[model samples]
Target: MAETNKPTATKGVLSIAMIKKLIGAVVGIILGVYIAGIGVPEGLTTKAMWGMAVFICAIVWWIAEVFPDYVTALLMCSAWAVFDIVPFGTAFGGFSNATIWLLIGAFGMAAAVGKCGLLTRISLYLMNLFPLTFKGQTLALMVTGTLMTPLIPSGSAKIAVLAPFAAAVSDSMGYKKKTQGAGGIFAAMFLSLGCIHPLFLSGSFMCYSVVGLLPKDIQSQVTWTSWFINALPWGITVLVLGYLAILFLYKPEEEKRLASTMIKDQRAALGPMSKNEKYVSVVLVLTLLIWMTEVLHGINATIIAIAALAALLGYNVIDRNTFKSGIAWDAIMFIGCIFAVSGVFSALKITGWIGKVLGPHVAPLLAGNIYLFLAVLCIVIYLVRFVLASQLAVITIFTLLLTPLALKEGISPWIMGFTSFVAINVWILMYQNAQYLVAFFGAAGGEMVNHRQMIKLCVAYMIISIIGLLVSIPFWKLTGLIQ
Candidate 1:
């Protein structure tokens, strides 16, 4: 047994994935430098060149999954400080942004709602009211998602609250996991979560963050009321179209009865509403009233959210520990990083530079045909979303880049902001969003959904989106959002 010597295995240094990421980082840095050097545009400055390099590297790391998104964000801030691209205070300034605090407050409120079983109780009550037909069941789920949007700013939280109910509904109907009924239910919830965010100012943290990024002059016009008025038509249109698409794509076999009593039983099991639930409900209603009446009160939405969160704690609906644990710190960090990056881009004048480079090329094409330009832009945004992972990230980056171009084309900033927000989230091709993926898998439970079925549903939704954009042009014109 001893005659032949065993060959010694080599101890590896970097794994293949790590090596690829390193190459990606290096290439990204080099590309950024090349862009800086070649950017002989009129408005661009030397500081923007360095900022571009850091921005590119950060994006590469984000796309490669080389590091966590927040970690990449932190690295970008650090790089900006280290390279003298911006001051340390400026780089980390996003942490202090009121929008970040707004998210924390909204998340805390959502946590309290979940903790008190308000979400489940409401969901069950809604399910009880809907007709027993398959379409009725789907509508119930969609309605639940829509109603939850104004309360729960976190999409993932809404999914968390609804996925179990959806599963239970499907199970009660004798539909197995991945069956048509189950898939349809999941799609309905998912699509509702996706489409309803832009409809309300408090519906998504991304909306607030976009507003924060706008210039002070334009910020006044991007109010909660304006956003709702401008975006409601498109949002409702997409919701209806998406619901129909899901039904068409995932037609559940005829289930003669939906077992309405199952949801009723669940509601009964929750017993009477607790005192805490009542308090939280009151607080939520008050918060929503304030949010919706921003025009009358003129109070900032962020302040209203914080005030509601404080009321929750004051009334013991949620304690300090609950509030602390409930807040999604990672999401806060990610949002902070996005705000920081946008701030640095503005400070470094990179946003201006982008306008200079693309203005001439895009200006002529957009001349005398703004709607045609917008239609094309909408399509381009959808295509670009394939590479990005986070809807928030997509909105932050593209909104920053494209807003200038839209402004140069003589479009209203409010219109640009609303359109960009909608375009960023119209993810109809794949479940790129983490929240959507969580909802998908959660609803699937043991039986995973068929990928092909999901794709078909997504394709139908995409077509609806395209048509919705075109049809909404007349509406936007009538509202004077687009002229």
Candidate 2:
């Protein structure tokens, strides 16, 4: 329940954004109606045409923010069913996906952890370990965020938890809003919190969505440990290069040491861990242990996550209100719809048609050289991020279109999928990264860091992200992801 700084439409007000959304909604409806009425195009079925119509509208609305993403998702599935583009079961199949439940379970656990302040105490304790200087605090924030990454499921949730502490530290150091010191602190926090998501399966909901989009056989092969192992090379590159990049890009106005009590006071404010904290800790740790050891136990992560959530609730670590409020139901709805949309896309043959249309031009690039293919793929997604406000949408669409070509090139589709996921996570522009924006304007508050400095960090992110994927090519080849 951390407050987000996303802009809202005021009643009876006609903001430029609202005007754009209205125009987008009307255009979306018109485009959908026109596309649907044009009859089946060559190489596409009537169902595919209908699916395209729904998709066009959904994409427009999604980019326009015409509705909550979950609401738009619901509309997509309902339209599919109403138009008979797919069966009701197929249109809504994402709800039946175990990935959806896993996300739910993860959110539940995150809620309990946040609600009980365990994450806060841990973060402050870690930050307090470093000397109070700008560089020290920056490193401390990065380490804290990275260590906490695997434990918390949501990147935004982690930002919400870390922003206040970062702000307090900045203030203590006399780094005013928009100053270099304040900007550095917040930028480091955002980078550390957001950049490493793809390194862990449960690190972001987007990771689960990526896995959900994979072929069933591949999905079966991916586990928490396996995902970590596969992404380690890229993750290490990003972590090392990204941290160095931050230090190089931003400098503090002064090198003043932090007041020792600033971080210590925050840590001490929590006093002793409460019973809820202890119980939630135990459940989360045990769940993570199970996830990491999935190869040995042969248990699915979803089951472990569900069990962990159940334990939290069963042991009263999460109260009824906490369960209802803590879990990100909107994320669940949106993620489920992503799965459903992917299913509908396949069922209607849209995915295959998309692959066919784009395949010839793209296949040549992917056919002979894995490194060349990855570079091209990363650049494409990075450019696509310019117009597409939704990172998940970009990841899903590119993965769907190029996966076939990757497979044809004797490459594992996972390389394509993971590469696209990393590429799309960048935010060179302010609007490109929603979670970063929310953290900057929401948790970190607009006063801490200005857009100029963050954009510099974002440019660094764009370069680092692409390099991370390209450098991982060797390791991926060693792992048989590339032949």
TM-score per candidate, chains pooled = 0.68, 0.69
> Model 1: which ten-residue window has the lowest total lDDT?
4-13
Model 2, 231: alpha-carbon shift in Å? 6.9
Off by over 4 Å in 2: 1-18, 37-41, 133-138, 144-236, 244-258, 366-373, 381-460, 469-483
Q: Which candidate number has the best lDDT?
A: 2
Cα distance off (Å), candidate 1, residue 419: 4.7
Give the clashing residue pairs of candidate 2, or none: none
Candidate 1 Cα lDDT to native: 0.68
Per-residue alpha-carbon lDDT of model 1 for 1-483, expressed as tens digits?
Answer: 343333222113346667878887777777777876775556767887777777777777766666766787788889899988899988998888776666566667767877788867765666678887678889988887888786656565456446655766666566777778778877787778766687888787677888877778878877668777777777778888888887787787766565766766776789999999999888878876766555556787778778888888888888778766655565566657766765787787765555455445544645567667666666665765653434565555556665676677656666555666767654343234445544554453324465456666666666666666667678878887665
As a TM-score, model 2 comes out at: 0.69
lDDT of 2: 0.75
Write model 2 residue lDDT over 258-369, tens digit each, in one string: 5667667776777999998888778877876776555566787788778888888898878899787666566566667766766776677665565465556666787666
